[model samples]
Target: MMKKRTILRFFILATLLLCSSSAWAQGHSYLKTAAGKSLQAELEFHRDPHQTFAVRGDNLVLAGDLPVNVNYDFDYSVLEGQTLTVDGEQQHGGRNLVSIVTSPGEVRVESGTMTINKVTKEGEKAFLEGTYELTLEEGKTLSGEFKLHTQFRDYNLSSLGWVFMLASIAGVWLLAIFCYKKLLFDAE
Candidate 1:
């Protein structure tokens, strides 16, 4: 009776371990864009399990094993002479990788060829262009747009222009009430 109980316990423990390992191996990797978009991809492990992996864009998440010596690139597009800010963050062990952001002027890559150009103000208008590259296992590229903006011949403003105009009218009304109470009315 004692021998049988020992054997049963051993078998149950072995099965649990196998199942756990299998589940961990099947986990997926994820990438998120700056515009609140997300994409997931499966990771393929080679030799080392805790190697460095690279991810680009915002809120990048990785599961399972990491990759070795990974490189990631990010690019952006904006109207010429426009001041833009770029940023990124990594989840899990993703910080071990190196990330680079290249704008249109700093380094220009076309048709797999790299060229350095003096990014300058082109007349009174310019078109923005950039790219992002990730060195990792083969997978699909996910993309999405951030906030929308209209480009005019001279200036650009947020898409909420109408909202701003309405707010201005409300402000004027409030100011008028304040002025009337202060100059023409008595406190009760």
Candidate 2:
């Protein structure tokens, strides 16, 4: 009877530990860049899970994959004296290229073109397309992009989920051990 009680106690503790650990081990975000043409570029702001910013001559492209709504703003000093264009429309801004787009879309500028697209279950990528012509200037230009992506899964338990799991398992285990000891060992 005593042996049975001890085994029940061990079972309860192990169950609680397992539940807590498994719950805490979920959900993470990361960034990834792919194989592509190298262009002179700088990142002024990064506000998403994965992002890329590139500049070719007078054209610029910014892309990313994200799980939530994020806003990023950037300035380009490289396009000092060039005219800006997007989707074939001329932009009057002194800086060559300025653009904004949601993820899985496109932002085309005089310096280049940028396309944001979904990459995987948990990732995304951006692409550059079109031509660029550079002039001369000093003050610089600004461009930005925004994205929102949300994913949900059942097994992807959050911190609260783990806590609940642990509490339930511990409670069950304690009750089982108490019952076994009272009815079997203490009764004997």
Candidate 3:
């Protein structure tokens, strides 16, 4: 009995460790500032989980508010399998435009490259993993890595459609109740 109990405890501990590690790998970012300060935080989709990420035009936007507020946008890029080099200009063209906001302040990626290392796609969901090394103003450098998940569509219903569906369900329930009452009266 004691041996069985020990094995059970070992399995429980192993399960907990596996679950925690997977949860931690979901989405995370490690950013270094110009002044040598480092900020590490989780990048989560704050809006609805259904709307994990978005691709507006040629821009890939990941906005979240957690341990730190971050708005990481890679302009002129969509999906994975590409490396975007920052030309130091903020103009939206073939050049990759990007921005990183940390706790200290906003740091513009002046010169460097952000490489999307891997992209895992399962159905409509996609996981993006990448690393970036950029030069900030005054010869300061910043580099980090990021892994995030995004969905293709939210799949939300419109207000009018919801109203129509609810009305139809209510009408059917009312009809059923009325028919039951009429049947009882006829039996009487």
Candidate 4:
């Protein structure tokens, strides 16, 4: 019975860990435009995960929806210097779609860790510093290398829910103890 209960407790804990909403969170992306413009988009809307702007790979699909409602999807690659096909359409001809130059290292953005890559200057390549505060074209200031995001990557758990979960565990343990005593020792 002890072994059974230990297994049961493990299962219950696993279930709670898996089904919890705080495990996953909404991510956001911050970008600076060529015109020195500042743009922010939600990962939920931009279709990125863990606030990952984009991964460097072949035929990578990248989209930046900003300025309200102008949806643009493009196929791009970071490892290879290829023309970024805008709108994912072959006919448009990706000549000057978007360019980026990233340094070799990891940068902390907001509460989560994000890759601080440069949104390359037209006709020229530029380097991005991870510890610098960036100002946008619209006069919006990004706080340190974190110009990309402004939040931490911690669990979004509610204090009330956490308390309730703890209480439930204690209650279950107490009930189990009472049941064990009544059945094993109090059986007269």
Candidate 5:
């Protein structure tokens, strides 16, 4: 009886471990450079509620570190299948922006289309598959596919709201300590 129970426990533990590993797996993404070199990276979509005055709506941001010390940021409107131009000249604050920074040089997107193939929702998170074909400033083409995981965020608190909440908690804590001290003094 004891041996059977131990075997059952080990089987259950191994099954749980296998299931958890699959749940935490990251999606795959890659971009081929102008020189025919492919850069692989994991990209995830995060809904950013904080946008500047110029930007119209919330942006679906894809920012991640690439191979060979490269970092890329791609921001697009939440709506799928909407084609927009990549602003290479302007580095920051624009709709449908694509910027890539490398160790030695920076590669900006001159023109191209980023197509969203499909989006699959699993519970609160979603998986996005897309492809991008970009013409670089160096007159080279960069294209690849991306499978990104979605990150859900709550908009209940802004930056100011967070600060105010902390301040209120501190104030209440201080008030409680002060009252406790006064009560002790009066009793003495």
Candidate 6:
């Protein structure tokens, strides 16, 4: 009885831990100082699960595996300030990911920004939730949260995705065994 309960608890915990993994999102801060000097920075941001994620005081190297037509540049290299202040609290989160095409492809963005309003915390990790304002190079802008069943053509299979998939299978298997025992053998 106790053993079965322990196993059940383990399965539940594992599911939660695996499914709530974080996704990385970033942007840029283009600003002009009080003296009208221009400066720029590529911002790699992480909200919850870590309000203290470090933004280095040194030179930041910004690079990505983004599409060809899409590219990032800082108007002027070297962030003017040694530090940047970031503070925002969002109470809602959890991303609903779906398959855009099933076989996997790519998501292309021309321009604009992606703002994650709320970040979900699962165990020691975090999950994605927010809206993207994308402007393709041809003078078009798209604004919306990534909706359910909307798959990225080239979806990056993150570790969190694997963990969540495996954990779900394990949870289902465990639950079936547990139910079978409770019904047939009366293990309670």
| Residues 1-188, model 2: lDDT tens digits | 99999999999999998987644321111112232222233222232233222222222333222223323222222222322223322222223234432123333332323333322233322221223332112322323331212222134576999999999999999999999999998995
TM-score of 4: 0.25
Cand. 4 Cα-lDDT:
0.34
What is the model-wide C-alpha lDDT for candidate 1?
0.34
Per-residue lDDT value at 118 in model 1: 16
- TM-score per candidate: 0.21, 0.22, 0.39, 0.25, 0.47, 0.24
lDDT of 4 by residue, 35-122 (tens): 4543332221232311123212121222222222212232111312221111211111222123222221222122212333433321
lDDT of 5 by residue, 44-158 (tens): 3322232211111122222321111111132222435643344443223334445553413565546565566676655545555667676766786666665555434445577
User: What would the per-residue lDDT of candidate 3 be over residues 52-158, giving only the tens digit for each residue?
Assistant: 22211111222211222222232212435665554454323222235444344655445666566776655655566777676776677766665555544444676
The candidate maximizing lDDT is: 3
Reference-based lDDT, each prediction: 0.34, 0.36, 0.50, 0.34, 0.49, 0.34
Which scores higher on TM-score, 5 or 6?
Answer: 5
By TM-score, who's the top model here? 5
Clashing pairs in 5: none
Pairs clashing within candidate 6: 22-126, 100-151, 105-153, 105-154, 106-153, 106-154, 110-136, 111-135
Report the CA-based lDDT of candidate 6 relative to the real structure: 0.34
Give per-residue CA lDDT, model 6, range 1-188, as digits (tens). 99999999999998876665311221223222234432233233322232222211122111111111111121111221212222121211122121111111233233343343443333422333444444433464334442111111223566999899999999999999999989999955
Q: Rank the candidates by TM-score, best first.
A: 5, 3, 4, 6, 2, 1
For every model in order, what is the number of clashing pairs? 0, 7, 0, 4, 0, 8
Residue pairs in candidate 1 whose N, alpha carbon or C atoms collide under 3 angstroms: none
Model 6, residue 102: distance off in Å is 13
Q: Which stretches of candidate 1 lie over 4 Å from their true place?
A: 28-188
**Positional deviation of 120 in candidate 6, in angstroms?**
2.0
Which rank order by lDDT, best down to worst?
3, 5, 2, 1, 6, 4
Error of 3 at 64 (Å): 16
In Å, residue 128's CA in model 6 sits off its true spot by: 3.0
